[model samples]
Target: MARATMDVMSSAPGDQAETPTTSASEREPTPAELAAQQGVPARGASHYAKGTSANMMRSMLVIVGIGLALFLVTARPNSVTPESVDVASAAQYRGGQAGQPFAYAEGLPDGWVATSVRYARSKGDVMVWNAGYTTPDAQYVSVQQAVDPGQDWVDTQTNQGRVIGRIETDDGTRWVQRDREGKVQRSLVHVPDDRTELTTLVTGTGSWEQLEEFAEHLTPAKVTKAGSSPSVSTSPAS
Candidate 1:
């Protein structure tokens, strides 16, 4: 009986040891392990977080590009308006200081903006008066007056142009028009019969009609009761 019991116990232990036992390394692969083996990222919290960050970055860049496009479409910054300069005040100051019969435009219709004015001495001690204006049609026109000027000065002011023809004003006063090499500038010269008088010139890039209109409004400057105040001629120059 003792031998039988011992043999049974020994056999039971041998059977238990011989049966196949699963080790930690021999278990079935989990979902995450399967994904890693397949070269696929697991759908975890961290992975979803990275995907959301990438999406947000792309969305921000798209928004910024759209905003920039809208701004460019709305902003038209090419055509700039020229700032108007105060020609009257400058002309007044110059006339008062020069103490001569300075010429300036007066009683002009609207849209005539003076861009510049000056009364100063030029080469050879020649007293010069200049006033520039933007015409109603956005053309440039200027008045140039010099006292006892030489031929060289005349040539310089007229851009070394050749006398083409004559232009008559309302008062039958004749002006000599010069033709320049290019259409860049035109000149109407009023050469005083007496060399001692003021040689008035109307010149600019304006059309002949615009130049005539500017010349018609030319008047002699006068000092006001306030001595320094500038005054324009009541009537146009003859």
Candidate 2:
């Protein structure tokens, strides 16, 4: 009771905070603070009361701000988003190379290699294009084509409208499924280059959360200038 009231009072604006109660002697405490007073004998209640009141007010403001920020982000999320580390378009990505451009990010070990991929929009709801290479073994085009099948496989696949992107590489499919335990899963993987793939299966998915997660891990190969190639970055632990 006191904790909830304290939360309400703290969340109220400055005017309300200062709007002294009808009986000015009444006060409430945080959930934790209220719990501590049941049996323990301590210093003056006034000692922490004022400080805690201030802290509560500060916390209220922080929480309100965070709520507003979350609302804004959730309400207006990006329609088409790309990741920073392994983006298909950004030239800064420094993975993948000549016949081995795709990097697999999943339940793999340290020995699992990663190459960059480049994706381009070629005039459809989903487009896949090339960026360049991070290694000499990276495939330049296969990585991008597998993820988005644009116009090719659209005619053959079922529920054609449900599919997205292009699939130019090996035998890869992006579809919805359920595990043996009856959990929901949405997955997509493409290895146009190396032909090996990685996937993400969201446990409980509703919106494009699964697709968003898949895009988050799908990286593109990095590209250098027309004449020069990108230098490899070494890991400290390696």
lDDT of 1: 0.75
Q: Give me candidate 2's TM-score against the actual structure.
A: 0.20
Q: After best superposition, candidate 2 residue 9: deviation in angstroms?
A: 67
For model 2 the local lDDT of residue 128 reads: 36
Q: In model 1, what is the error at residue 231, expressed in angstroms?
A: 13
What C-alpha lDDT do the candidate models reach, one value each?
0.75, 0.37
| TM-scores for every predicted model | 0.60, 0.20
Q: Name the best candidate (by lDDT).
A: 1
Clashes per model (N, Cα, C within 3 A): 0, 38
Report RMSD (Å) for each prediction in the order shown.
Answer: 17.3, 22.8
List candidate 1 segments past 4 Å from native.
1-80, 223-227, 230-238
Best by TM-score: 1
At residue 90, give the lDDT of candidate 1: 57
**Model 2 spans with C-alpha error above 4 angstroms:** 1-180, 191-219, 224-238
Give one digit per residue, the lDDT tens place, for model 1 in 1-238: 8566555556454465332456878999999999999999886675435768788888789999999999887775634454566555656666666655667888889988776666667767888888888888778888888877887888888889899899888866689998688757889999888876778889988888888888888877664333556444221111
Per-residue lDDT of model 2, residues 116-190, tens digit only: 433334334533333222222211111233343533443222222233443222224444422222433222333
